[model samples]
Target chain A: MRWINVLPGVLVTFALLLPAPAAAKTELYSALGEEAGISRLMETFLLEIAADERIVEHFIDTDIERLHRLLTEQICELVGGPCVYSGEDMVTVHTGMGISHAEFNALVENLMTAMDAEGIPVGAQNQLLALLAEMHPEVVKL
Target chain B: MHTNKFVGVALAGLALAVVQPVYADQGRFIATGAATTIDGAGGGGIVPWATLSSYAEEGQWGATASLTEVNVDDFALSVSAASLTFDNRFEFSIARQRFDLSTIGGELEQDIIGVKTRLYGDLIYGDLPQISAGIQYKKNRRFDLPSAVGAVDDSGLDYYVSAAKAWLDGPFHRTWLANVTLRATRANQTGLLGFGGDQNDDYKLMTEAAVGMFINRHWAVGMEYKQKPNNLSFADEQHWRDYFVAYFPTKSVALVAAYADLGSIAGLDAQEGIYVSLQATF
Candidate 1:
C-alpha cells in the first residue's frame, strides 16, 4: 500500500476528534436530586435488587435499612451532594464477598432500572454509573 | 455458484440461530449493539463499528440476522446477512449483496465472509477507546461484466481496524459514541465492479467514521461516512455518507433509516437516496 494514500484518512480522523457541541454541566448532585432524590433512588434501587435472583443472595444476611442508609450517603457524596458517606471502605466491606464481574454488572443493571423508574435521565444515570464504575476493582475481588 | 453461496450462508445462519443459547447476563448495556452494517458487521448502516454483535456473554454464544436495502437514484442494493459472536470476543459473519442496476440493465451479486475480534479496551469502563480488528473476504458472482470493464480479479479482501469511545455524561449531558476505522481495500464500487481494476491493482487505505447522540435510551441520531477507492477508471468513486436514525423498541429488534449519497457509480451521477435496515438479535 502506498503510504501517501493514507494522508487523507489521517487528516479526516483528526478533524473528527475536534470538539463537538456543548452540553450542560453534568452535576451529579443535581442529576440525582441531591439528598431527597438520593434517598428515594436508594429505596427504589434496593427493592429492585431484592427482587433480582442473581444478586439477592448477597444481601440475604445483611441489614437492609443500614444498607440503604450507607448507599444513600455513599452515592450522595460521590455525586457532590451535601451528605457525607459514613459507610466502610469498599475493600473492607467486599473483601471476603467474592463478588464477580457478572454479579456486579447485574447489580448495576438493577440500579439503572431503579433510576429509570425514578425518571432519571439517561445521561445522568450514565454519569452516576461512571462514578460508580471506578470502584469495580475494589468491589469485585474474585 | 452465486446461488449456492447464498444458500450456504443462509443455512449456516439458520443453524446458528437455532443452536445458540440466548442469555440475559451478557455484558454491555441494552441498545448498545448499534445497527447492523451493510457488510454484516455490528455497526451503523454503512460503516462497521467497534461494537460487537448483540447476544453472547463470556463463555456463551450469540447470533444476529439482518436485511438492509439501499436505493440510489438509478440503482438499488440489498443485503442479507447473519453473524455469530462468541464470548463477546470474536465474531464470524456472512453477507450476500445484490446490486440491481436499473440503468445499466444487468445485476451484480457478491458474497462476503467476515471475522472480527475485540483487540482490547472498553467503550464505557476505561479511559482508552475500545479497539477491534476485522477482515472481509469478498467474491463477485458475475465476472463477465467486470472482466470486460478491466477488473483484474473477481475476489478481494478488506482489512480494517476500528476504535470507538462512548461518553456517558461528560461535557455532553447526553450519551454519545464515536468510532473511527481505517481500511485497506482493493474493491471497486465496494465490489460491485469487482476488485483490482486496470487503473489500480493495489489496495488503498480509506477511512470510515460514525458519531451518534442518544436522544433517549431507545432512540439515537447519527451520521456515518466511508471513503472509497477509485480503482475502476470507467467511473469516479467518491466517498459515501449518510444521516441516520436508529431505534430499538426492544432488545431483540432494531430499525434504522438513512438518507445516503453513494456518489457516482458506472458513470451515473448523484446516487443519493434512501436506506433502511432491520435487525434481529438473539
Candidate 2:
C-alpha cells in the first residue's frame, strides 16, 4: 500500500492504543463502595456462585461464610481498599482441583452478573475484572 | 451452485438447533466467538483474525451459519457460509461467494474451504495475545471472465497467521480488541477473479488488520483493512477497507453492518458501498 493510504490505518491503530483521558481515572476503591460496598458485593457474588450450576460443585463442601470473607478481602486489597488478601495464593488454593478453563470462565461470568446486580458502572466493572483476570494463569489448572 | 455438502451441514445445524438443550454447555463468554469473515473464516467482516467461529470452549462443540451481502457502486457480492468449532481449539468452515457484475453483466462464483487452529495464548486472558494459523482453498467455478482478464489459474490457496488481543480496561474505560494478520496468496480479488496472472503468479505476502472497541458488551464499532495483490494485467487491484459496527444481542446471534471501499475491481473505479451480515450460532 501507498504511504498515504497507510497513514489513516496507522493513525487508527494508534488511536486504539491511546491512553484514557485524565477524567477516566476514577478511584476503583471508592467506585466499588469501599468496605460496606465490597462486603455487600461479595455477599451477592457468593449468592450468584451458589446459584450457578457450573461452578457450584467446587464450593459444595467448603465453608461459604469463610469463602465470602476472603473474597471481600481479596477484592478490597486488589482495588486499593484498606485491606489485604487474607486467603492463600491463587496457585496454591487452586492446585490439584482440576479446574477447567470453562469453569474458570463461569466463575468470571457469575462475578460479572453479581457486579451488574450491584449496579456497578461498566468502567468500574471492567477495572475490577482486569485485576481479577490477571490471576487466570495462577488459578486455572493449577 | 456448488452445494451438496452445504445442504447436509445445514440440515445438521437445524437438527442441532432442535437439540440446543444438549449443547447448552457451550461455555465461552458472550461475544468471544468472532464474526465470520467474507472468506468464511472466523474473524472480522473481511479480515480473518486469530479467534475461532463459535463459543465452544473446552469439551464442547459449537457451530454457526451466516449470510453476508456487500453492495458496491458497480458490483454486488453475496456470501453464504457455515463453520464448526471444537473445544475452542480448531475451526472448520465452508463458504460460497457469488459476485454480480452489474456494470459488465454476468456473474462469477467461487467456493472456499478453511481450517483454523488456535496455536497459543488467549484473546482476553493473561498477557500474551491469542495466535493462530489458517489455510484456505479457493476454487473459482466460473473462469471465463478470469481467462479474458489474463488470469492463469482457476484455484488457489491462502496461508495466514493471525494474532488477536483484547483489553477489558482500555481507552476511555471501554473494552477494545485488535488483530493483525500476515497472509500469503496469489489470488486476484480474493479468487473471485481467479488466481495467478500475467503480471504475477507467485504468492505475494499481504498484511491485514482489525481494531475495535466495545461501547458496551453488546455494541462494538471497528475498522478493518486488507491488502491485496494486483495480479491481473487487465485491471489494477486495490486494497480493501471497511468501518463496521457489530452487535451481539446474545451468544447465539450477531449482526454487523459496515461501509466498505473496495477501490476498484475488474476496471471499475471508485467502487464503494454498504455491507451487511447476519450470523446464527448453534
Candidate 3:
C-alpha cells in the first residue's frame, strides 16, 4: 500500500514539470489582411487622406506613389512588422505646412474616418492615434 | 404664426428663468461637479461648494439656484442666485446678494451677472484636469449709506481661472479629487455687487484650494479654504472660508451641506454658520 501511494506522487510530479502552453503572438498588421481579409485597406486609407480637402493642400508637392509607399512602410513598422520607414522626420515634414491647431485637428478627424472606413478596430485606432499624438507639438503651430 | 411667436416669447422667458447663468458646449456634455463656489470664488476660495450637474450637451441646457448667508459684527448678509448654461462651454449667471449691516442699521444689495468658458483639458483625462476661465460683472443697486465710507459704484468686473482634477482609484481612493481657483476682482462691496465703497474698488486677488474624498459612488465630502486681501476701511475686511460635504445621486443632481466661517465684517467677529445648497443639471 505504501509503494502504490509513492507511484501516484511520482506521476503527478512529472506532469507538473511539463512545459506551459505557448502564448499567441500578436497579429497586428496581419489582422487587417489575414483576419479581416482586406489586403488593399491600407492603400485605400492613404487615398482617402490624400483626397481630403481640409489637408490635401499640404501634400501638393508630394509624389502620391512615393508618399503611399512611405506611409505603408511607417504603418508596417508601427504594427510590429519588418519594415523601416525611409520618410522624413515629423518635424521636417510638417515644418513648412504652417498648420494651425484647428487644421491639424481636422486632419486627425479625417484620418480617423479613413481608418474606420477601412474597418480598423477601435483599439487599433487608439494605439495608432497614441503614436501620432506625440507629434502634435511639432506639427501644430498653435 | 402670431400664436407661435407668442409661444416662442413665453418659452424664452421660461428659459431665462430656468437657465443656470453658465452655458455648455457642443459634442460634449458639461462634466458634472464643476461649479465655482459662492461669491464667484471657486475651489477652496471663500466658498468650497460645487454644483451637482455637469455641463449640458451642445444643444442641451441647464439651470442652478443657490442661497448664501454671511454674518459679521452687526451685519448679516444673504445672497440668492439663478444661473443658466447653454452650448456646454459658455455660461451665464445672475445673482442678487444683500447685506444687512446690522450695526449700521441699513441694507445693501447688488446684482451680479457672469460668463465662463472651458479653455483646455478634458474631464475624462486621467493625467490632466479640467480647466476653465470666466469673467463676472457686478452691478450695484442704488442705496444710501454714510458718506464718510465712500459711494458705491454701480458696476465692476471680476476675472478668474479655475481647474479641477479627479483621481480614478475608485470610491476607496483616500483623496478622490481637488480643485484650485484664482480670481481677481475690484473690492467694491461684499454682499452681491460691491459692499465696501468706491474707494475700495481696486482690483484684489483671491485664491482657493479644495480637497475631496469619496465615501461611495453617490456620496463625497470636501473642505475648502479661501484667502483675500484687506481692502476695506470701514471695518477689518473679513476673509471668507468654509467646509462642505456633498451628496450626488447622479451627474445631474447634488445636495451640499456646509459649515462656514467668514472671519469678520466691519470689525466685528462674524465667523460661523451652517450652509446648504441643491443643484440640478440637464
Best by lDDT: 2
Write down the worst ten-residue block by lDDT for model 1 chain B. B1-10
Q: Write model 3 residue lDDT over B1-282, tens digit each, in one string.
A: 223433443344344444553332212212244443555322322543222224453445666555444444455556666566664456667667677666656777777777777666644333566787777777667544523455445567777776665543323222256666677866543434243454465667877556666554356666665556565566565555556676654444445556776666555675566555444444
Which residue segments of model 3 deviate by more than 4 Å?
A1-142, B1-31, B34-36, B40-54, B69-75, B102-104, B146-148, B170-175, B188-201
For residues B1-282, could you state the per-residue lDDT of candidate 1 as single tens digits? 233433544454444434443456565566667778888888898789878888554566677888888878898888999999887789898999999888889999999999999899876666678899999999999988888888899999999998988766544556778889889999988887899987899989988988777777778887888889988888788888888988776566777878898878888998998887777787
Instruction: For residues A1-142, write the lDDT of model 2, one tens digit per residue.
Output: 5664675368557855665333322398889998789999999988999998888999999998899889999888888888988889988999999898999988998888889899998989888888788888898887
lDDT at B111, model 3: 73
In model 1, the Cα lDDT at residue B161 comes to 96
Off by over 4 Å in 1: A1-27, A96-100, B1-25
DockQ of each: 0.29, 0.52, 0.02
Q: Tens digits of per-residue lDDT for model 2 on B135-251?
A: 999999889999889999999999999998888888877888889999999999999999999999999999998889898788899889899999988899999988899988677
- Candidate 1 lands at a TM-score of 0.87
Among these predictions, the greatest DockQ belongs to 2
- Reference-based TM-score of each model: 0.87, 0.91, 0.54
Residue B248 of model 1 has an lDDT of: 73
Candidate 1 CA-lDDT value:
0.80
